[model samples]
Target: MDISIHRPESLSGSLREAWHRAADESPGYANPFLSPEFAAGIGGFRGGARVAVLSEGTEAVGFFPYERTSLGVGRAVGLGLSDCQALVHRPGVTWDAQELLRACGLSVFEFDHLVEEQKPFDRYVTGTFASPVVDLKTGEGGYAQWLRGAYPGLARTTLKKERRLGRDLGEVRFVFDERDPAMLRTLMQWKSAQYRRTSRMDRFARPWIVNVVEHLFRVREEHFTGVLSVVYAGDRPVAAHFGPRSRTVFAAWFTAYDPELSYYSPGLIMHLRMAEAAGREGVRVMDLGRGEKEYKDWLKTRELRVGEGFVSRSHPVATAHRLWRRPVRGLRNTVLAHPRLREPADRLLKTVGALRTSGGTGSGRERSGRADPARTGSDRAGPHAR
Candidate 1:
């Protein structure tokens, strides 16, 4: 089989067609983030966003939506924070991962949450993390049953909290599919504020990110839909969650709540409502993406492991680059692995957060609050090929 790569000129028609074909033919193929529309929509900036079509003769067998970067690097579309699979490929294709890298002119391909199905590329990956999920197939009743059977104490606590919240707030209401754009704007503002407070990068501050999120909010498909659920206290919106939803999965992406309603745990209440709504919509899973949050443990029924690693072709430059980055990567990872440093890190973050809260004095806040609007388009005509 001869495998040739096609870097499409435009991601509109041809790219979507290829992605549809691959998705239909592939198992567990319902990842919205892997779709061409998603890549083009969200991966419109920061250079090196491209669609790679792998064909055996004339028929396309695989599609890889990637972003090329410096250090001869290639990353999965929406790499830094995206909680989805990498590379949408057909089931029976036999191609060397290295060959594909060479064909794409990539030195190193970095994936944070690489899927397990890409067997050829598994060898290059390291680091393992668990993604928590709630089974929603049985609807609210089913999940409720599981909750009682699995984490009775947590479920009781949540129910107690819900009651307390209602009692304290007068009346608690949940609105699913809140189509108000104002709500989204509010959520972005709150999320941005939270990011700054935490000394982290605010994704919504980036024009491309903001554009992509807004576009995705309007995108409605069987496999990929953005959900904006709001929890209300009386007539006031207290919490909002903007996440991606598929037929069987509701992926929790971004969420924010009013600090005034912190005593009510509006965020947790919203999540509970989200799970119930997902079950009603025939969604069987609510994926609370990576990271260890107490809420995830409280709501999750099981955990799925996803990995991160780098794949490189036998190019000398690529290998050298990988070797060079290894030590730095190791040091960072080591620091992250230690529990003792958490307090200091938290203190630093709190300090930065305080500064950001105080009214943006440093570069961190500046970088996090503003994103160039002009760079909200795909940059394909560059040395870095997707």
Candidate 2:
């Protein structure tokens, strides 16, 4: 096989065609982040991105999209703090990993949430982390079965509440692709409000993030694109979700619901609908991102470990940085890993976040009002979501 590289001007026509073809030919198929449009939308800030094509004679066999960075480093295009797959290419195609690295002029490549099935670089990876997932292929029925078997009491109670919600409201209706821009705007508003109220970083405040999400919404491909779904009661939008969808995976990204409708568990209902829609669309997995959540555990059939760490080539500075960074990170992780210290640490963080949120200088009332009194756990929403 011969390998060639191209720097495409735009993700239109032939480039898109090549991307889609390679995506379809991939073993696990295309990841949204691997799509040229996604890369182009977000990669503008990282200098010009390039496409690496591996071909045999006249046929293209593999495609790798990447952004070259200074100091001899490269990252998957559109990876800027996002959690998903990287280095998408044909499954069985074999190339010298080191050669590719050299060709890309990268001394070290860093990734936070690399996909689990990427085998060529397995030896270069240092560690792995678990990302929980929900299998929605069974649809709502399958989810109910899993929940009943895993947490019988919680499942029963939630079901009873669901029934009560139906009784209180006229009828609970779930809609996938409600196609309301107003609904998406509302969801972003609520999500931003939740962030401020909880002393978390506001994602919608970022221009790049807003642009990327809006761009993804308009992008439609067979396996890789953004999907926005909303659930409603009567004419009022109760809950909504925004995420990237592939043929076999619906990566659960951002979600928010009406606080007034909290009693109805709108968020959970939205999840159920998302799963059902995914199954109907022939999707098999609903990647709930990372961290441990009761809902994820309830709906998930299995988990995959993935995380961001660094891999250094022969660069001494990069090697030293990796060595120093890991031990310090390990020590910090050790402290945070303790179950007992978690609560107090979380409370302290909440307090700090509350302070930051309330003008960065506030009296008790300002802080108290912004702080969620019922908040039980740390918001594990990672940097990728932003």
Q: Pick the candidate with the highest TM-score.
A: 1
lDDT of 1 by residue, 9-76 (tens): 36546556767777867645665666665666655554577667777777777777777766567877
Give stretches of model 2 more than 4 Å off.
1-15, 25-27, 44-48, 138-155, 163-170, 316-338, 355-386
lDDT value, candidate 2, whole model: 0.63
TM-score, candidate 1, is 0.82
Clashes of 1: 1
* TM-scores for the candidates: 0.82, 0.80
lDDT of 2 at 89: 59
Instruction: Estimate the overall C-alpha local distance difference test score of candidate 1.
Output: 0.66
